[model samples]
Target chain A: MAEQDLTSSSILIAQAQTDTGNSEAQQPGNAAGTNDAVEEQVVQEANDAAQGITVVVEGSEVVAADPAVELHAETQGAYTEQEKSVFPPFDSSTFGPQLFWLALTFGVLYLLMSKIALPRIGEILEVRRDRIEGDLAEAERLRQKTDQAIEAFEAELAEARAKSHGIADETRAKIKSEMDAKRRDVEADLAKQVATAEARILKTKTDALANVDQIAAETAVAVVGKLAGKVSIKDARVAVSDVVKG
Target chain B: MAGTDPISQFKVKTLFSFGTIGADENGANGVDLVFTNSALFMVLTVGLIATYLILSTRGRGLVPSRLQLVSEMSYEFIANMVRSSAGTEGMKFFPLVFSLFSFILIANMWGMFPYFFAVTSQIIITAALALLVMAVVIIYGVWKNGFGFLKLFVPSGIPLPILFIVVPIEVLSFLSRPLSLSLRLFGNILAGHIVLKVFAGFIVSLSALGALGMFGSILPFVMAVALTGLEFLVSALQAFVFAILTCIYLNDAIHPGH
Candidate 1:
């Protein structure tokens, strides 16, 4: 409503200014037209001046000018002494020197109100609104910054976790491969030792058998004389060799 | 001193009877402390305005009651007055202008009551109102436009020789505002009241009588009634004029050269 009023008033003022401008432009050319208007005003004033002279009309002393003269006269000066007594002048001074004081008093009061009271009210309201707006904007900005930081931290944390999991898996695979190679080498050495031991056992048995036969033959030659003793040695050597083979 | 007679006499002297308060040092006890007659009416006028405004505004609603409508109407009326004369730039002064209108309207209507005195009848009151309005124009104009407001006193597009003659006339007219504004209201209201009083006293003095005499009495009574209504219009109008002029003055203050 207030805005509308301001707009309407501005429109009216603009319209008025335009009208005034147009009239001003036309004034110079229309100066002759006002000459008749001036003459008419003079005639009217002359008639009014002549109104003071009275002439009898009907039963009353009406002025020659018009009935308005008679009406004016009767209103101003018609009352006689008896009529005057009926009406008394009100002694209230409406137009005395009091006007100056009134103007002075009003001037001071208006000045105080316009300068002091109004400005204070306006200033307080403006400051409050500004403070509220500033606080809101600051809070919103802070909230946005916090949200961005949280998002960035979460993204980095996820990347770190993935990298650690990859490293752990690679270390486990390397350890498993080395353990397999060591196991193979140990198994091969143990197999070689078993084979060599078998070979040695075979050679010792063969050699013992050959030595026992030769010794048994010599003992037999000698034992021809000694009979059963040499035969018993060769039998003993054969028994020992069969035992070793088993 | 004649005691009560002195007090009563004092009431007649000073503007709105400050003499009574001033004369308290001499004598007359405290009888003059309480307001009476015209002063009493002045108080009544203020009360009437206050009461009406309060009652009209109470229980305010979006749709509005009849009383609220009147209150809003008064606000809108003065608001338009300021906006029209002062433009959008002048709307900041709405509250002040509206208050002036309401106060004057109440004062004028209060006079119609049998025992009330019209504040506008007092030159001091009218002049003070005018001064307040004029001061707002000058002060706010200068405040907003700075030294530019001085251009109001010096019109544009004049021959160098004419500048001296035209500028003084414009300055004098500018200075005459408070005088013209205060006097117009003071004279109109004062004259109307005096006419009413004289005619009313006549009605009292003349015994209700023969056909013509009775008919003659009716004329003053009718005139008085009509004048009462006109006085109401004048009261609102004078306040409006005062505010509008304030806006115009403010406009000059705002846009000095134009």
Candidate 2:
């Protein structure tokens, strides 16, 4: 679709060029008049050709003005009239132009593609690939760092737990030894107090026994004075001492 | 002229007649270097290709737009085709293969449109392109491989007696490659366009007949439409065939034996 439009436009441009050439050639006298007439005829022919109508070349002036335009019109007319087998594309006459343009265009395109377009595309592809690979490498590196961090955290946690357990054991052992020493001191103080109390009690008991012997001797002397009891004071003391001994 | 005369469409009309350039007298039977519709369309093909490649890649974004995606896909498609057919070494010729593919594809597609000249339909153009490919193959083949390139015709493992019979056939076949390659593309596109024109002519002629002709014209019109669809496929397929064949020939140039 685009090709046809471009071709027609190119044909128009070619027609305009021929028209200008004719105008330039006839520029001396009656130039404006011939130009106006030639332009009108060319426009009509172009329109007719576009409409697929056979354009009738009316005036000799238009034909005289531009022989090339007339030739183009006649050629187009003859083209439709002649059998397609005799077409110039098949004819050797047009192959030169066709091949010439083909080479020219193909050469330009090859240079453009190889030199400019393909390399740019290749660079884009290469850049995208490199970016992706770099991102993946970075992600892998970060993942490794995270793994190392986790490993370190676990190691530190284990160390802290072991340290806390040792501290607890040491505190428990120190408290247990201090309590045992305190209980031993209290027991020794109680034993010493009991020994001193026993000694004092023994002395009190002996003194009380001597006082009883004296009281018995005095009572025996009073009785002897009063009767026969006085002579027996020493005997009474000895009897009390014997009874105490027994 | 009959409306169904399909060959008429192939006629080349001179658009601008510049009598020969640089030469005073008419040389070579007055073969003036007049620009014709063929040149115009060829130029258009180049323009379109440039537009497609350049405009599509203008952004050069990492994440492609639709047009960029299409351009990239076409690039990768031809790239892979060259790689697979010709191997990694063939990638060096990717530009040639890609240009040929794009030009032919766009030309064939352009021909499908009404009033457009299919450049590939012309024998001269296809022949020129095919000859260029053959030239590259021969030049590069000989330059790169020296005499080893001749081994492409002579297989290794053939018995001595059978070698005499096989070598000439191999040479003949190798020589015919360019002809076959050019003709294959030209013939397919030419025949396809002719068929389409004939069918379209049917509708015109039938409808001109009368009421009954008008009803009959529908059949030809429908057939033309269907054929247009098929021709679209043929256009792309022929371009692919041409390009892949070029790659294969280049591969022979690179690795000649097997």
Candidate 3:
């Protein structure tokens, strides 16, 4: 219901606005018959409008000038004369007060500005300047610190890399030497075992040769006994041994 | 007839009277220390300057607020103007310069309102201000430079025969400083306001004639608006000119030479 009332009120205001607009529009059309009449009417209304503003300024002046109620006959003529003087700026009656107030207000302004606003504003500007310079100095210091930190970090990293390389090289050298020594020792042991096996084979061959000569002599003796009975076995062995030697 | 009269606006209507002192020779009643519309606007002008400047610097933020920015801008603007014109030694006069600048600037702006009184429009007011400026200049110059401040009138480089022509001119000009300063301001403000009123009155008068009059009033209305803009510029510019002149005059006090 409130929304409806608001909308209805707005519509009424809009209609009233149009109505005034139409009335203004209708004036020239209604006065179209007589040009001189229209001109006179315009002049008359313009004069009234001009008077309206004058009265407003005058009314405010009257209200402001005095709350004292006295419209005496003597003051009325003086008022007209005062109003007729036209150029109030040149009027000497106002000079004394204007000068007085100018001094007072201008004095107040100078005091307020000089003693209060100027110094405080100056201080604010000074404080801001100091703060900016300090902040910039602080930022420079922090940047330098960051640069130093980066340098130290890089230095540490390079040192750690160098140390790891040295350790790796030392370990590699030590392991290579140990492996060389073990290879030489294993080769020497294998050579010693091969020499002993070769010596034992040669001895076995010589011993077998001696046993072959005796067996030949015994075979030869057995052959002779079968041929010439048991006589001259020693002599048959001697002959077989001499033939085998040849 | 008096209402439409542009000159009527400058009338010093007393707002609050402290009673009459005595009747003058002209049979006019003399009022005792009555506060007029002129005084009201003057007080209002001072109040505005104080309120704005004080509030602007109140926060004192590292990152300045918009108000603070404007406040500081005005501060630095006057400060730089003083420094440039008067040199570093002239910084002592910063408060005086700032006050005059803000006071005039604000007063002129307040008068831009249709019904508001323009304090500077009065000859006596401007003359008083000009006298105040000259007072500061004379006092400070004499105090600082002693008898040597007379060098301001006599050029050091000019030949003796030419000095005859130049010295009197310089003296006359020096004597006329207050007059020129006061008249310059008063005339500018007084003329600008009168013109603005006349143009505005044209609009009001024309627009009262109905539709055809409304269309015709447009020309004056536009002209008035344009004049208003120019007046605003003049207001600010005159303030700057006044302050700078103050600085230049103060510079002579600091270093009284060509």
Candidate 4:
């Protein structure tokens, strides 16, 4: 954009220069002729379709300042004004004493900035940008790795919880079954002991009744022998029989 | 500090004479084609700018060293100037504008040292610079719009009746380019140096009084010190303004009459 501006302005100055000069004053027309020549070249390339270079040489004065005289007069007057601004105006003509050195300074400066200063700056910015981008990428990669590790850890925790719960349930069932079996064995042993005791009591009662019957028969025989004298043996035998039946 | 009389002490005999071609009867005189104090220092400034910039930029690393950092800062300063004033679309002119800014700034600042002659204090130097800028402005303006650039002299919005009066003023203003541009630079630089010189003169003349006068010399010395710092800022500002104005003038060329 800027280059175009410079080019266009130079062209404007060239046009103004041409307009200011008569045909005879075109000898030192360095910038104007070049500009016109460039326009002509553009036209010649386009051939018939192109607009020929129309030198707006004879336009109204309101349009363009004659570059040749206008630039010279303005610069000259500016130089005088500048001198008056600081020192006594001195000689009005001393305005351009250092013109060559000024040009030299500008030329030298332009080269340094363009060639040296600008590139260094560009390089620094490029590096900084690249560094930031690289750091970001590295951080992202680390974050992704950490996320994967965390996911694995969470999965392992859930599996461990399930395994622990399963073990607890199995242990609870095993303890309950063992306690029930032990209770059943204890109840059966207690019932058998009660049955044996009942059988022993019934046997003792029957033996006592048999022994009493035998003893009564013996006593009745002895009494009859004694009462045979009194003819009582039949009575004694009947009494014994009665006792055994009771 | 080069002796107390920096400007006067560096004076050299006039080498030769020249003329302004056709603009004035005498082109340019005082010193012809040889190296004088101003020329030597101007060359020194260029050399310093070149050597330092080259050394700073030789390796071109992603991370800059101290030297490289200075170089980069200078670059960013000019780049931003072009970008902000001229717009992003005009950033391509960064190299040119940035170079001009740095060169002028460095030259102006270096000239501020005691006993150092400010090159910008010379009118011819400033005029040449102004001419260069004017040349750029006019050439670009005509190139973009051809005859339409003539409209720049006659602005819009004022009543038609008032144009007759406004036209001459506008034309004179437009024609005052080299003067305004050059004088702005020359006047500022010259004024600063003259002020510094006058104060130094006071300090010197006052010291002859006595112990009381010696004590009083503090004020002038302080003022000179303060002025020196101010001069530094002014030099940088002037250079920046010069470059910015050039960009503005170029803008006129791109969009003529605006």
Can you give the TM-score per candidate against the true fold?
A: 0.46, 0.72, 0.67, 0.57
Model 1 per-residue lDDT tens digits across residues B1-258: 122121121122222333323234434322222223444444455455555655655554444688766655665676677777778877777657655665566667776665455667766677777887788778887887788888887778777899989888888998898899889887877777666666665565443666677767777778778877776777677766766776777677667885
Clashing pairs in 1: A102-B124, A102-B128, A103-B127, A106-B128, A223-A226, A223-A227
TM-score of chain B in each prediction = 0.79, 0.95, 0.93, 0.84
Highest lDDT: give the candidate number: 2
- On the 0 to 100 scale, the lDDT of residue A187 in model 4 is 74
Alpha-carbon error at B90 in model 2, in Å? 1.6
Q: After TM-score superposition, what is the CA distance of residue B122 in candidate 2 from its true location, in Å?
A: 0.9
TM-score, ranked from best to worst: 2, 3, 4, 1
Error of 1 at A4 (Å): 75
C-alpha DockQ of every model: 0.02, 0.28, 0.31, 0.17
For A1-246, candidate 4 gives per-residue lDDT tens digits of 334444554575565445544332554655777756755654444332212222222232223333433344334433211122223222333334345665676676776666656666686688888999999999999999999999999999999999999999989988888888887787777777777776776676666655555555556667656766443545755677776566
Model 1 spans > 4 angstroms off: A1-246, B1-39, B205-212
Taking the tens digit of each residue's C-alpha lDDT, what string does model 2 give over A1-246? 334554665687677668766776767566677777877877776666644422222233333444443344333322333223344347665777788788888889888899888888888778888999999999999999999999999999999999889889888888878877877777777777777777777777767766767876666556655885356677767765676678
Q: Top TM-score: which candidate number? A: 2
Interface DockQ of candidate 2: 0.28
Residue A41 local lDDT, model 3: 61
lDDT of 4 by residue, B1-258 (tens): 323543453232233333234444454222334335566667777778878888877878677788888887876776777776667755756776766666678779888887776777777677777777788778877876899888887788888989999989978988887799889988898888878887887788678898888889999999988998999989999998999987777666666664
Q: In model 3, which runs have C-alpha deviations exceeding 4 angstroms?
A: A1-83, A165-246, B20-31, B154-173, B207-214
Ranked candidates, highest DockQ first: 3, 2, 4, 1
How far in Å is the alpha carbon of B125 misplaced in model 4? 3.1
